[model samples]
Target: MKRIPLLSTAFIFLWFSTTAQDTLTLSRGQCEAIFLRENLSLIAGQLNIPMAEAEVKQASLWPNPQFTLDEINLWATRHQTGGKEVSPPIIGNWGRNQQYAVSLEQLIYTAGKRKKLMALQGVGVEKAQQYFNDLLRNLKLELRRQITELQYLQLSEQTFQTQLQSVNDLLSAYERQLEKGNIAAMQVTRLQSKQFELQKELHELKQQNNETQKELKQLLHLPPQTFLKLSSEQFERALTDETIPTYQALVSKASTNRPDYQLALLEKSYFEKSYFYERALRTPDITVNGRYDRNGSTMLNFVGFGASIDLPLFNKNQGNIRKAELGIQQAKMLSQQVLHNVETEVAASYKSLLNAHAFQKGIDPKYLQRLDHSLDAHTRNFLSKNINMLEYLDFLESYQQNKLSILDAARDLNNAVEEVNYASGTELIP
Candidate 1:
């Protein structure tokens, strides 16, 4: 791998440490590092793991003891016997009066239900972590694709703007010539139409560039209107792999590394555990009770301990057990389906990568650069009447089109590498 430039490192830590300003320039490595640290979606994904763990904690906890305060009369009823004076009881005679009874109940787990529930919730946490990893993987792929696209768009836009500037200058000069009766008005009109066409195309590409940048900014959590200056240096780096990995190797690595596959396996395990938990529910929880009454029992300060259990006469969690069993089969089928999909995607992306590599290998970049250099001389010659306008325009258009093609080829190579890495669930490009 190439080392990141010192300036890019500084900018990544300094400018990108917070919300970006009007313009931000970063190398691919810097951008990816910042993304790992600061991307909002990744942050949300990470947060979910803790939440799942919290659910596990909740599952392992014993149910809170239920406290009861019964037979608490709001007002005392005075019993007037033989017209004797009678009064409502005050707070001091709480024990002697028959006004209040208190009890406490605790749900005791049977059949290791708490442990089984905790185990089930543990699987849920694993699933959350796997989902987070999958999200990070996907975003990394998207980031690389965005970086390559923006680099290509920047180069293409620069070339078009430069040509547009030159055409505007020529149009101004030709307008002056027409006023002096040296050039026809119809010729100036043709030049204006060509300029308008170029402007329209440029505008459309600009909108596309903005849309890509906006999506990238959302990932980085940057201010929406901030300008993204994607560095072309990383895109220009040559592919260093001598050969691609075999299909079997990629598929095997994907089975091990792909979070989606692992997540599916975890889902299957979770459902299996859930089936156990549901079956455990058939053994109804026991509720033990301890109570104290003021004066109801013949014995003073009566204290009692009792227990209760729901008889499994009708509902025995039969429906939930069936659902859990069905869930296991569903999860198994889905895992297998994911394996098939990953294999197909890896094979297809490998084929596409091969085509992109062959196309890029055929192009000679330095030769194109020299040819592009000759374009300025050609344009100047045409303006000086040393070359015909038709020939000059033809060569200029070809130059523009060829440069766009070269940039597109680079983009294709970069995109293909990212696609393959994503599908294979490994960083094959690096």
Candidate 2:
């Protein structure tokens, strides 16, 4: 019978939407597993390996043989005297329509060209495999990063909701007191305005959470309705010790362990092989042919074999050989560049981990709890006229901000550790 106000209806709708989303209960390992099993990009990248292998098999096959029919002759003659013409024609005894021979030829050799081609195809397969490995590493790291971000956002949103609820309750009490003429209408209006601001903040946080959830769903290759609830406790446990490898150690580990750098090394080797294979192509190719002939009338048979070869006088494949050599040089340069980048990344991530560790150590949970209790006491005192409203509000604001900062710092530390592990090409867990 009663209708809700527009703002109230809107708030209800927002709340229901936020709560109705599916929740995935996942740890970090579970998150990584889901991406490995489900992410479409990784799946597609994996398919490239088989595709390249098929190419290698195709390249290894020899060329098909060629078949030829040599000659078939038909004769026609007009005779002045039929008898004389027939006798002349009969001189080529038993002249059936003449048929000569059939021949077949297969390429015998290509001066190691087939070997070079197969080598090139083998390089292609190696490159594809290395690329797949690189993709796998990047995909796992991205999944971990996204899950961490979502967990942090959820925590932030929950804290904001709690603060908003507290503010709303206080505003409702103020409204009641104002109706009884025990509080000024201006005071009630100020409290109501604060409540509205908190609601706005809560709405913004929820929107951010929704966006992150959508990204996680996409990463997991799940439908939009799929729920994701992360294990915050597990994350907290993961951040317990905060001990990390030194910068030099991290660099060394990354150089040895990072798949991207290893892939680059493999690519360089492939190019080196390609350059040599191209140089080997300067040799000429030889082709051999064979044929057989038979005449049933005389019971005579003959066999013959012949060969041909390319001189390589004009085109020595000089341009292709030079290009392949240049490619080798370029690959080496790129390998060096990637090594430098990996070292720099490892150092940077190590520093970030150290800083995060120090920042987290500076946070005291008990101190925050005490401050929360004090802020609550101050609010009660303000209601009883023992303290001013400004002091009470300031204390509440400071307490809430401190709580948020601590949670944020914790999440940052966890993320920093993840970064260190990612850079060093290792797992943070275990």
Candidate 3:
């Protein structure tokens, strides 16, 4: 063999390690960690927490103080030398020519407006937190669903391949029988046609398997060409024999643990705080002013302080306060709506789980195993001229179809349980 570059060999080894590490023979906890660390949307959702915290900080800060300076002239005068009487003084000569003044005024109170604003900010932070948690839960559920689907598809593909091989063997036997004049030409042609159909179906399943892998990779945010293989035993153990919670218990759990409901409650509180803050606007804010003046001629300085407060005489913020009150009402309505939706979803998902479980129970593994053996016997009999080609093909097709259906049913049951867990805010996986 030609010498492989040292760098190339190292790269190959590194690639294998990286890909293998990413393969993730995932447990429920491992799936949760991957979502927390790698899922882009969930990571982006975390930024909202800091953003809301900044808003709270902003709400707690006081307003900047205002400053003012003034100058007065004290030695300027105009003289009129005419036959008419002169004015006493054209300009003031007793006031300061220049003055420097600075004053700091802090808001004394705003009738609990600041406290209300801070409360609203707290609600915002809570809402952000709830949203992030909800996103994490939803992403994990979807990932589980896809993983389960891929497992089912892989199993189905194997079943189809095995069936295809058996059919090929039977077809070969039939051709040999035709050569020996033990079978009609038409019978051999029919067997060939059936084998062709099975091959076509096998090809389709392979294509589907490829597509499923691509989807799984996309969900995991891994490179498209990554060589990932799931451990079937691990997957089966993850979902097998799960004990579902009671409906009442699930509803209670959702009320406490579901993030969307918590978010709605936070929003209602935020709007209520806003209402109170707006109502506090009915009280006017006070502005205090202080000034100092100096005269150039006598170097005299004057200082004075005064307070100014706006009268709510013209506008008393009636419209804005009314709007805020309405907002509180709206938030309450929305909270009710969210509660109803959660209850409905929990009921529906639980029902689905029950139906899927029933279907799974209805399937008899022993009966299927016996039927599979029978189909194999029939196939062999057809090859040995004890049965016809048509009967062999029919038995093979039926056996494969039944096996595929069983696999699909099993997968559906797993997905339904995941759905129930997700809707009820239960940690079924981890």
Question: Of the candidates shown, which would achieve the greatest TM-score relative to the real structure?
Answer: 2
lDDT of 3 by residue, 240-295 (tens): 33566678988999888899999888888877887888888888887776766443
Worst 10 residues of 1 by lDDT: 80-89
| Candidate 1 per-residue C-alpha lDDT over 249-357 given as tens digits, one digit per residue, 9 for 90 to 100 | 8888889888889988999999999999999999999999999975446754679999999999999999999999999999999999998988899899989888888
**Cα lDDT for residue 372, candidate 1:** 61
* lDDT on C-alpha atoms for all candidate structures: 0.82, 0.72, 0.72
Q: How large is the C-alpha RMSD of every model relative to the true structure? A: 5.4, 8.8, 7.6
Q: Which regions of candidate 2 deviate over 4 angstroms? A: 1-23, 70-95, 110-112, 240-242, 293-302, 371-376, 428-430
Q: Against the hidden reference, what TM-scores do the models get?
A: 0.83, 0.83, 0.80
Which 10-residue window of candidate 2 scores lowest in summed lDDT?
81-90
Q: How many residue pairs clash in each candidate?
A: 0, 6, 3
Put down candidate 2 lDDT per residue, 61-163, tens digits, no spaces.
8888898876533543444334343222223565433335667887754557677778878878877877887787776767777787778777777766766
For model 1, the local distance difference test gives 0.82
With a 3 Å backbone cut-off (N, CA, C), the pairs that clash in candidate 2 are: 22-227, 23-227, 23-228, 24-227, 24-228, 24-229
